[model samples]
Target: MTAARAWWARIPDPVVDLVVVAVAVVDVLVSLEDSSRLAQAMAALACAALLARRRFPLPVFLLTLPASLMLDIVFAPFAALFTLAERSRDRRLLVVCAVLFAVASATPWPLDDLSSHDRTWTLVYFFYTLATAAAPVLLGQLVQARRDLARRLEEIEEAREHERLLHSQAVLARERAQLAREMHDVVSHQVSLIAVQAGALQVAARDPDFKEGARTIRSLSVDTLDELRHMVTLLRASGGRATELTPQPTLADLHKLVTTSGIDAELTGELPPDVSTTAQRTIYRTVQEALTNVRKHAPGATAVVRLWHADDGDAFGVTVTNTPPARPSLPLPGSRQGLIGLRERAELLDGTFASGPTGEGGYEVTLHIPTQSG
Candidate 1:
């Protein structure tokens, strides 16, 4: 099917003229014995010119008329008219050409002379002239209509195909989100029970060693719970639920984030309370993604989390820089879209986010969010 389509597409317009030349050429050659050499030469020229009538429709079409001085140009005139009407959108020019051919068709020829006869024969000649001349316009209009209909159908099918692809992507995204919700529910339940048992162990322990172990276990379980909750928040916010609380974090939440992550961090500058909710969420997510990377990829790194407000109070942002980890540890691979998502979020809000390694062998993530109208 594909090969057949390719072959048809490669076939050019001029190929159709070969059949046209054959029909007109036979008429011109048969009249050679009776006509003058000049008349036969002119007829041959007019018929040969029909081969390129589509390329120059009006000029070649006119060449085949009364001025050819021989009756042999034949059906080529009608073919040229069809090509003109099929290709050009100018109705006035087609009408003028049709009128010219009709006028020329009334002239008497040796093969089919009728104008030299009585009233009844003249009427027959004129009827034949108009019928032959009108054939092309009728055929061209039909071809043009079918071509237009085919083009419209192709465009509609292409649009439907694109819509189907997008729907499939949406379905896959929903399935992944459902699976994440189920995993988090089961894991969270187990973690909560561990934390509760560790709390009881801490209360009953007498030996210093056992007391310290119980306390450490409870602390580790609490940190795990926090991380689990953050993951669940992200999953639901993206797909199903938690939309109302998804952007709840503000500039004020950075202090607790730093403490819980066990990073030796320093906080500096004023965090403006009046920042817009969307900008705040982007700001919070930027630091959160950066800190998450630091913990996973740059373990034990000290981070400096800074927030600064513009003097006009219309802009506020945060920058978090973390030193390279003291000792490297193998970290599991993660979805690498965090930085890309942060950049897109910031740009959507007419803000900016920049991240890269610093000269001091640390990674830095910086964001500037414009909150007020200019």
Candidate 2:
């Protein structure tokens, strides 16, 4: 039944209107036999009026009443009534139109010739016609309701999709904010240290060349810090959630980090003390993120954090490896963006970051960066 209604709805409006007019004309023709010329003229006018029913439903319906009173016919008036019912929302007006249709259908033409018996039959037929008229009104109302329901459903679906998009945008904004905070904490600490050390070297150096180099390093480090601070401030002002910026960890803090980590871990190996402050911070973060992952995904695991430099002192990095978990790990909520941030940090320093499961059912994370001279 629904498929049939859908197919009927697919018909073009003009085509549907033409079909209604044609059907009304046929109804009038069938009723024209043995009718007076005046009745024929009224029937023709009623059929013609149906062509304009969609634009002027009440007027067309009124026109059909004269023919209905003069001749025996059903299509023209019923079609006009259905159109009016579908478009009109006033129940009182629809009821009045239906009653008018019933009366026009029931009344006899040339009223002076009516007998008492005929009058009784006319009253009975009036009730029957009114009852039948309800069919078109009811059907028209159903169509109107169905159309409204479809439009409302479309609106609801669009609203849900819009909500989902907003939620995704909110998540992305939060992630970017967290990234900014991490950058400010780590980068600001390293650059500030560089400026301090350079200033010290510039003051103590005896040779003119060494003094000039130290002065240049101090100036560049200070400028870089200023730019970095401004950028971070802008990011926070735009939309980042309020957060405290704390002192960043460096190589010196590794021992405390490993000891406090919930996992059993060993820290070993050392690099030259002259390694750049930026490099030291990157090594620190690598170990931090790796140990955090072990505690979350590899519970009861023993980890090894090894810091190393190349034989020629041209490159240096840290490697953190953890054995398979000795106990079941608990489910924990995480953003899963720690590694991505680590990778981005490595890229900024022309370094490499890698992490994956080892052959012994363990996990390994490694960071490699070129050494920078102080």
Winning model by TM-score? 2
Error of 2 at 215 (Å): 4.3
- lDDT (tens digit, per residue) of candidate 2 on 1-374: 87997898899998988999899888888888888998998888888888899899999999999899988899999999999988877778889989999999999985677788999999999999999999999888877667655654554465467669978877876776776787699998899999999999999999999999999999999999999887776666443455344344678899999998766999999988887767777888889889978876776689999988899988888999999986445455679799999998898899899999999999999999887632
Give the alpha-carbon lDDT of every model.
Answer: 0.74, 0.85
Query: In candidate 1, where is summed lDDT lowest over 10 consecutive residues?
Result: 108-117
Task: Give me candidate 1's TM-score against the actual structure.
Answer: 0.52
Clash tally for model 1: 0
lDDT of 1 by residue, 9-56 (tens): 788766767778888777667756677766766677777888888688
User: What are the C-alpha RMSDs, in order, of all predicted structures?
Assistant: 19.5, 25.0
Q: Measured by C-alpha RMSD in angstroms, how accurate is candidate 2?
A: 25.0
